[model samples]
Target: MDLSKYLGLFVSEGGEHAEQMARELLQLEGAAVAPEAIDSIFRHAHSIKGMAASMEFSEITELAHAAESLVGALRPPRAGSVPRATVDALMAAAERIAVLIRERGRGQQGEGKDLTLLLRGRAADPWSEPVAEAIPLKVEPAVSLRDRLRTVRVRGETLDELLDVAGELLLETSRLRELARQAREPLRAALDESVDRMHSRLRTLHQRVVAARLTPLSVLTDQLPRHLRDIAHQLGREVELSVAGAEVEVDRAIVDEIADALLHLLRNCIDHGIEPPAEREAAGKPRAGRLRVEARRERERLILEVADDGRGFDTKKLRAGAVRRGLLSIAAAEELSDQESLMLACLPGLSTSDRVTEISGRGVGMDAVKNAIEGLGGTLAIESTPLEGTRFVLRLPLNVALIQVLLAEVEREVIALPISKVLAAIEIPSGHGRTFEFQGDEAPVYSLGSLLEWKEIAAGSAAGRPVLVVDGGGKPVGLAVDRLVGQHEALLQPLAGPLGQFPGLSAVTLLGSGRPVFVLDVPRLLEA
Candidate 1:
């Protein structure tokens, strides 16, 4: 078997183990280091060392080997309390290892260096010198163990090819379904059932393949806490960053883009959002500031929220900054709501910081963050209060590859509407202007046929005409369709060339009959 294809799995595993070690070291900083913690850290270091050595990543293996020795020295039997100085050294070593792991993760071989001096305690220091011994592994792989091949790496392009092949298979399945529907006779029925089962199995496999391309949200946010710790110390504050739902998954492409923006947001939180320890105490808050990052699946979107318990936004300062920068007229700034003015930070070419600081001040500001998130088909919004804190929330679509689509006919053309975007389908109520009032809100209820430029040929020919009520920011509009054809699991295939520029269309799907059904872009239509 070609193990080159499996390089991604190895990288992902190594990154995960490195992150686990970082988290443990941070958590055990002041607490009595338990034997379990020591063993946990030791095992991670040992495993990483073995893996890196096998891969001939000398620098990574050396760092891991050093970490293992230190952790091993602390294991078990109240032999002696771990010296504060020793714990500090281990923490620094863990941080360096994390940086190396991240660099390797980004496809860079880390710079080589001997960290033995840093790992060793001074001769007179309380900590004992690391005991030297032969490498720990007793058995090695039977295959060629010494040769490390760097060329055996799979780029993301390989996965994209697999996805395209799956899309073609979906088109074939659609053709088979159409053929089955047109057949008549007992033999035809049996054939249709057999083909349908095959289609179902193929669909399942497609989903699994696409899902493997997803990376967890926690993976992107993993570095935040450690950064926050260092920033808190530098700024003379005490803070604890708690992250949950690190397991919520998103496409790797989206995760990579979001990680950079996440770093900036956390930096802003530490530098601007959180108050100093004394001020926090005066406000009847905990001496240590608290920052929390959470991820959760909400419908078809993955929501990531970063919140901090610190002095929140200074709305007055924000408004003043906007007016000074000439982004908003003085009069307009005066009339703006606190929330509205607070959003000015996200305006292009705007910065609230008066002077450049090492942490935050640069020409690039929240505007960059907003663009990056939106570029990923995600939205970024902020909520803050002066005395309370601030929260930046990002909502991103799960993946573009697959969606549960409800097929409906608009005039003579078939359109696939994402099931998540559809509120409900109902009969259009009788009204002039082709409009309807839903929940005391008036919205123009247009026929899907008219919307798609398909003039209705025959109205009322089909009983119980379906009108799909779709949401455009809480205001639901009815889309009258000739029929609710049925539902199917669809692999969203991108339209080719300029046809992709069509409005209100996100992608196209092939039905069981080999016919292309356009998938409605619900969000874009709502904007219209």
Candidate 2:
């Protein structure tokens, strides 16, 4: 029987088990052992052991057995805190397991196996050798672990292919709908209804495909605590990190990109935003600073925030730094709002740190983070208060594959505006076209067609034209279009090659009429 088919499954489950075990062991450090946590950790170790045993991976089995023994010893019929030394040993073991699982998954076979002594934080080979040795154990082989298939995991490439097929179907459906609308008068009604039904079903399929690709942010964030623990010890900073709403799901692509962005934010906060324990205590703040990474859902978007409660950003210092670096003139720097000034931290190479350090003194990470979020069709906002704290807020689309867009006409061209970003669609009478009268503020209005350099069809028309009320920076603006074409769902396709080089365009999608239209990055469009 071939075992290659089972390799992906073993790696996936084994990796998860290793991470979970590490997380639980982290909680046991310098704290009273919770019976449930210990039991959970023990079960995870036992599962890995059994799985490895069934696969006849002697090295993994031995390592897992040693880890299991340590956890089993800690599991209570007795009551006492797990020793810090024991916790470190187990943490190392868990990390070793994760490394081994990843290596095996990548098709890396061991040079050889050497025993790892984990329980005592002693190892014959430091477990650095692939599938190195570990303490031996005698336990019945539970190979049934091989037979239980809990979930069918699909490769990311397979999903991407499915999405491509779906996108093509979307275009075809749109083409069919247009053909239906243009059909002979006698047959139009039935054709229209049939096409609409197909559209509905296609939408449901698109949704399922998108949902299947949703990944909980927790998978990337769960390791943050352990990382923070390690970094705190290195930095001499006492910190309490709170991670919330990591269960919030987002497209897998976003999650993957955000992993680095989140890490950068965390590292920045710890190295710069967070003050030393002594400094914090001297400032009438708690010795341990508070850091939080939180995620929330708002309609079709996800809001992620990373914050630190330490010595906050000093806008004056930021301004001075920007001016010193020639990124901004002295007058320009002074003219900036405090909020804008604080954002200077994102300016490349503009560090306010008194001395340069490998951790963060070079101001590069924030700008990279900003660019990354924006590339994902997201926005990053910076907030800071002197002596208070600094928070970075990122608002990102839930799924980039399927987008709900408000279609509008500009002469013969159809363009898409992300519906989530457009506050409302209204029509202003011919005479009032220059100003947008909302619930009741007058905002500057620009003809969308004119902005696109198209012949303005809405110009001088007796009848009113459609205006998409949009958030222009922080103020309201009216974008007048030739006409409102109703809302439509679009499959966002990446603009490959040179088409991707254009500014003010986020993505392009094909309309039912077989028209290719660009989805405007509203803010960028307005700015451009």
Candidate with the greatest TM-score versus the true structure: 2
All candidates' TM-scores? Answer: 0.55, 0.64
Residue-level error in angstroms, candidate 1, position 39: 48
User: 1-528 in candidate 2: lDDT tens per residue?
Assistant: 677777877886787788768856755654444455677789998999998787777778888888887777654424555655556667767877888878788877542133255453442222222343333433335445654455578999888788778767876877887788778976999888677767766665765677788899999889999988877778788889998989888888889888999988888888888899888888999999899999987545689999999778878888998888889999898799987887788888887777666665488788898878877878788898778998999999877666779998887788899875787787777566456577678787777767755333343451377778888875788887787887777877767668665776888877776678899888877767
Model 1 poorest ten-residue lDDT run = 133-142
What TM-score number comes out for model 1? 0.55
Clashing pairs in 2: 114-132, 114-133, 115-133, 115-134, 116-133, 116-134, 174-512
Could you give candidate 1's per-residue lDDT for residues 1-528 as a string of tens digits? 454554554575666567667656754554554555677778888888887776667788887887788777664525444665565566656666666767766778765354445554321242553355322222335345454442254567776777677767765776777777778888678978677666665665566567667777767677777787887888787889889989777777778778878888888887787878888899999998888898876545778899998888888888887787787889999998887777887876666556566787643658889877755556788899888999999887777566679999766777899876677777754433356566577665666766655343244322256778787665787777888898876776666667755767767777766677888877766555
In order, the Cα lDDT scores of the candidates are 0.71, 0.76
Deviation from native of the Cα of residue 479 in model 2, angstroms: 2.5
